[model samples]
Target: MTALNWKLVVDTRDAQTLADFWAAALEYEVEDATPLIDHLLKAGDLPEAAVAEHNGHRVFRGYAAVRHPEDPYDPFTGIGKGRRLLFQDVPEPKTVKNRLHIDIHAEPDGLETLVSRLESLGATRVNEVDKGPAGHWWVMRDPEGNEFCVA
Candidate 1:
């Protein structure tokens, strides 16, 4: 099979809000789809109902994304081709434990500082787990309760 590009997709109550949190947390850049959104609207290829003003720019109403700051992106579409996370709005709230989660690795001796920063950004500490010889890490939840680990 040919190589495939991939991105993590997450469901959120508010795409923009979640994107904002993740962007700041990861020091990533929120994808800018304003130009494409505008062009599509003008060409009648997109409906106004599907787009809305967010952070002062047009974005898809039900979706938002963040990309690694140095990643390459399609200039006109603002779509990232490298590491990315896409958030899409969903009517249902998160009600179960995450089947999959992200693990953030901090620079040596930086875990504590990273944890503090994440807490300031609305992450809540769930608990810390220490596995003999395997190391220890902190379990935390995002603003919307999605669990992730910091090590």
Candidate 2:
């Protein structure tokens, strides 16, 4: 049997904004991939219309990436973390609840700070979920409606 690597790639209306939110929330870096864009442009492989600057990084007119600061990265492609959240541009808004979502744990005395911080960055609390034993978690959404938990 063989095993393969995995990551979550999300479709979003605003990729760069979502990327920034996640980068701050996870203490991750917004990977600067402008070199790839430049290379592709020089090679005539991608159109100028397909590239743009977003959040100070050269992003795909449709995509951007954020990953944990301490997360392990693939030396070859620069992909990071055992887990990563990628934002790609999409035409439509999110229309359904996420079937799967990311879980976040806050350091001691950090939950309130984190929540306020994320909210300021445009994440809003959807509800407080008190599942058995877990007590409570703030079900929150990114500026674009992708849901995640903050505990």
lDDT of 2 by residue, 1-151 (tens): 7677677898888888888888888888876777777878889999999988875656778777877677787653456756677888878878999999888888886877888888988899989877867566789998888899998
TM-score of each: 0.95, 0.85
Task: For model 1, name the residue pairs that clash.
Answer: none
Alpha carbon lDDT of residue 35, candidate 2? 74
Best by TM-score: 1
lDDT of 1 by residue, 39-124 (tens): 99999999889998888989999899999989899999999999999999999999999999989888898989999999999899
RMSD of 1: 1.1
Error at 116, model 1, angstroms: 0.5
Clashes of each: 0, 1
